[model samples]
Target: MGSNALINKHIDLKNKKILIYTGNSFGLNARRIMPSRPKTADGILRYAKYNIVGLVDSTCSEKNVSQVLPDLNPPNSPCDLKQAGKKIPIFKTIKDAKEKTSANVLIIGIAPKGGKMPKNFIDDLVWALENNFDLVSGMHTPLSLYPKIFKAAKQNSRKIWETRISPTELPIASCQAYKIKKPIVLTIGTDAAVGKLTTTYKLAKMANKKYNTCIIPTGQTSIMIEGWGISVDKCEGDFMAGAVEKMILEKEKEENPDIYFIEGQGSLSHPAFSTTAIALIHGACPTHLVLVHRPLRKRITGCLLLPVPDIKKVIELAEKTVIPSFLNTKVVAISLNTSGMTDQEAKKIIDEIKNKTGLPTTDQIRFPKDWTNLFMGTLEHANIRT
Candidate 1:
C-alpha cells in the first residue's frame, strides 16, 4: 500500500488519552545531549493534536513533564493541563501511568540509532500491548512485525501504527516538482538530526498566519506530528524522489497552499546518510533552502571519522546540485541549533555564522520573533507572496 493508504489503515487517534513511553531518555538534559533520540516524544509534546495524559520514563518518574523540560509548555500545548494549571505528570512505568491518567494509547517516544528496538523497550511494548494499550511508534522497527508484540496486540484487540513505512508503489522522478509555481522552501542540514524538522515547523507555523502554507513532512517524527507524510528515508533508492513528488502533488491538489516548507532528512555532506538529502533536493526541486546547523557539532553524528563540511560549501552544494533540473535555487537562510548555549553564546555564534555565510540566521525556537522576521524576509526576497 502507498503511504496514504497505510496512514489511513492504521491511524486512529480519536479520544486517545496518550502515555508517551520515553524510557530513560525523557528529560531536558537528554534532549540537549541527544536531540534525535527523544524527537518523537518532544514533537508530540510540543505539537501533537491528541491529549497527552502523562509520560513513562523511569529515570524521571514522580516529576512533572514541565519540571523536567520547562520549555515543553508552549502556548496551548496538548500536554498542558489548563484546568488544573499543572503540566502532565511522569510515571515510571506504563501500569502506573495508565492507571493514573486512564491512558489507552502508548506511543514509543524514542528514535534510537538504526531505529532498533532495545530489548528493554521491546519488553515494555509487549507489556503495554497485553495490558490493553494501543501502540504507536515512529521508529523504523515496525511493532506489527514483532512476534510477541503482535500476538499481544491481537489478543488484546489493540492497534499498531508505524510511521516509517514507505509506499508500496512509487514512480521514478521526472522533476515534476519544478512545474509547481508556488515557492517550495526545503530545510537542508549540515548533518542528520540537527533541528531541520523543528525549524521547518516553526517557519511554516509562522507563515501560516498570513499565507496558506503547508509543511511537507519527510521523516518518521514529522509524519507522526503531521498525521500524514512519507518516510522518505525508508523508500527505495530509485523511488525516494518520486514519493516526495507524489506527496507534494497530492497536497497541492488537496490544500492548494501558497507555499510549502519541506522537512529535510540527513545531510548532503554526510557519508553515512546523504541519499535522502539528495533525493529531497532533486525531488522537491525547492526554490529556497534553509540550512540548519549546530555550531558545536564539528563531526557528523554517528560517523566520528567524517567531519562536517563548512556552511558555505553545503549551501553551494545544495544550490548547485539542483541546477541540472531547477535553476536559480538558493540557500536563503541559516538556522542554528544553539541548544545548550547561553544567550550571549547563541547571539555571538549566530552573528558569526550570519557574517560568514552572509545569510539571515537565528535559533527558531529560542527566538521566535527574530526567526519570523528572518523567514518572512526570505519569502519576500524569493518573491514568494506573504
Candidate 2:
C-alpha cells in the first residue's frame, strides 16, 4: 500500500520475446483488442489497444501472422471473426512472421463465435507494452495443454503478463440480506430490442421458474423482469444493475425477500462496462458477483483469473487496505458465464479453481445454471455501499 508497492507491481517488461497461444474460440476472443476507428459503438477507450500490431489466426495457418499484419495488410483473421476487427496479413507462422518482421511480442487470442471474451478494448497494447507478459491464442494451450507456449516464452525469458488485485474487507454493518421473495430480475442491454438484457431476463426467468418466484421488469422499456427503475444508457453498460440495485435496497426489508437481479451492461473489457462494474460493486454491493465474460481474457490478463486470485492469500496481503471499514459485509456468490461448456468442463474448471486456491468450489458458480433462488430467502445483509 505504498509507492514501493505500486512500483513493485509491474508487468515486468524488461527485454524478452513472448508467444501467447489460446484455444480457437476462447482464444480468438483475446485478439479483439484493437479497434478500427472505434472499439465500441458508443466509444470510451482507444489508448489501451494502440500497441497491438495485429490479430493472427493460428487455426488457418502459421504464416497467418504476416498475412494479417502484412507489411501493408492486417493480421491473421480468425475463423469465427466477422472481418469487422482490424486484421494483419498472415505469414507462414508467427515464428516465420517474426523472423520476417522481427517483432518482439507474440500473442494469440481466439474464442468461439458469440463466446468471445468481453474484455477491455486496449488490453493488448497496455499489457504488452506496460506489463512484461507475452501473448498467445490457442484454446487448448493453457486449458488442456500448451506447455510449449509458456516453455517457448520462458525459454525466451519472458514472464506471462497477467495479475489481479482483489481487495476484501469485512463489511461494517450487514445492511440487509438480499432474498428472492418474488425474484425481481432486471436486465439492461446495449441495444433496445434484445442484447445482454434478454440474456439476463432469460436467466432470471429460468431461475424464477425453477424457484417458483415472480419475475420483475426493470429496463428502459421492457415487459420482462419487473423492477421499479429503468436505466437509460446501454452504451455505458452498468446502468441496468446500477439503477436497479438502488431501487431494490430501498424496498427490501427483513420480512420480504428483496432479490435484485441486475444484468451487466457491456462486455467486461469494455471500458464503460468496466467503469460501470466498478461503480456497481461500490454502489450496490450485491450479494453475488456475476461476470459476463466476452471470452477474450487471455489478451488482457494473460490468464483467466477466476474468483479473483486466491482471496485467502489476497486477504492476508491486503487486509491493510481495510475494505470492511467501507463496505459493511462479507460473503458473496461469484457466478461465471460458462454458457458454452459442458457440465464436465464446468466441473473441471471448478475443480481447478479449488486446486489453485483453498476457497470452496461452491462459492463460484458457472452460468446458464439455475441456483433456484439460493441467495434469496436466505438472510438479508447490507454493506455501506462505498
Candidate 3:
C-alpha cells in the first residue's frame, strides 16, 4: 500500500491530515453490518500517504477509535508508519473534523451497495466543500455528477476525485500472464470484504524481504494507497479485464518484479459483483492463488437473506473455471479473517480449515509473522523463488 518506486510525482502525504466518514456505522454491531467503512478506515490507518486525525461516525462520537475498530486493539500492531498507537478522535460531522483537526482531505470510506451515497452523506460532503477541503470519493456516483458538489468545488477551489471511474481509453486484454515468465499470485476470497486486499498487501510486504515483488491493486482504496492501479470495478464491463492487463504489463516493463502479487476483489458467488471478479481473475491470469475466508460470516455483507456458500465449493468452482486457461491454477495458501474472535475460537477455525483443505491457514492481519512464514513456505513449494 505504498507508492510505486517508479513513479516520479510525489505528494507530501505526511503534511496533510485526513478525516474518515462512517456516519452511523461505528460500533461493535456496525463493525459486522458495515464492514466496508471500518475496513477502509483500518487500511488508511495502516498505510496512507497522509495522517489520519479523526473519524466521523455520529454513533461513536467522543469515543476512542481504538476501542471500536477491532484491528486497532491490543495484540494487533498499529498500521501507521511510526508503529505507535494514536487515539484517533471521533467526531459527529465533517464540520467537527474540520474545526478540530483542520483536516485537508475527507475520504469517502464506506463501500455501499451500488456505491450509492448514504442518506445524509451528501450534507457532510457539502459542508467539507464549503470549508475548502478536497474530496476523495470511491463510489459509482462521481461527485462531478452532482451539480451542487461540482459548483461547491469550483467556488472553493477544491478538487473532487472519483476513484471508481476508469480512464476514457484502455487497451484490450492480451492474455499476457501466459506469455510472461514471472509468477503472478492473486489473493481471492470466498465473499466480498473478507480481507482479500489486506492479505495481498501483507503477502507482498513479506515477499519483498527476500524477493523482488510488486502488487496490482484492483479497488479504489488500494489505488489511492499504491499511487498507481486500475480500479477494475469502476471501469466499463468490457474493458475491466483489459485495463487490468495493461496495468500489469506496463508495471512489469518498468519495475520488472520477480513476482506480481495481484490484489483480489469481490467473490465468485457474490450476486452483484461476480462479473468484475471473473474479469479480474482472467485478466491477472495468476499461476497460483491464496484464498481468503471469514469463518464467522453467515451471509453476504449486503444481501442479508443470501446465505454464504461452503469454502470448499468456492475454491473448487474457482479452480474448475480457470483450469482450461491456467493449467496449473490452484490455491497455494489460505488467509482467514478472524477479527473479534477469541484466541481459542480463532485457533480452532484455523486448524479445522487446515485439516479440511490440507493447506496453510492463519489470521494474517492479526498475526503477520505467522502469515509471512506460511506464505514463504508456499512459494518454496511452488518453486517460485527469487
Best by lDDT: 1
TM-score of each: 0.92, 0.33, 0.90
**How would the candidate models be sorted by lDDT, starting from the highest?**
1, 3, 2
The residue-by-residue lDDT of candidate 3 on 132-174, one tens digit each, is: 6777777778776676676676676676666777778987776
Candidate maximizing TM-score: 1
Q: Go through the candidates in order and give each one's C-alpha lDDT.
A: 0.81, 0.33, 0.76
TM-score of 1: 0.92
In model 3, where do residues sit more than 4 Å from their true spots? 1-14, 73-84, 304-306, 323-326, 384-386
Going through the candidates in the order shown, the clash numbers are 0, 95, 1
Q: Compared with the true structure, what per-residue lDDT tens digits does model 1 show for residues 233-302? A: 8999999998988889889899999999999999998886799999998889888889999988988899
Cα lDDT tens digits, model 2, 1-386, are: 22211211223222433332332221223334422111121010111122334333344443333332222222321111222243433432444545544556544342222223323313332334333444422121131123333334444444332211111222222323233223333332211111344344344444544443322233221211121233322213334344434445554542243344555443333333334433333334443333222221233232233323333443232222222334333332323334346767766665664455433332113322333243332322333232
> What ranges in model 2 sit over 4 Å off?
1-229, 232-246, 249-257, 266-270, 285-288, 291-296, 300-326, 339-343, 354-386
Model 2: lDDT of residue 255: 28
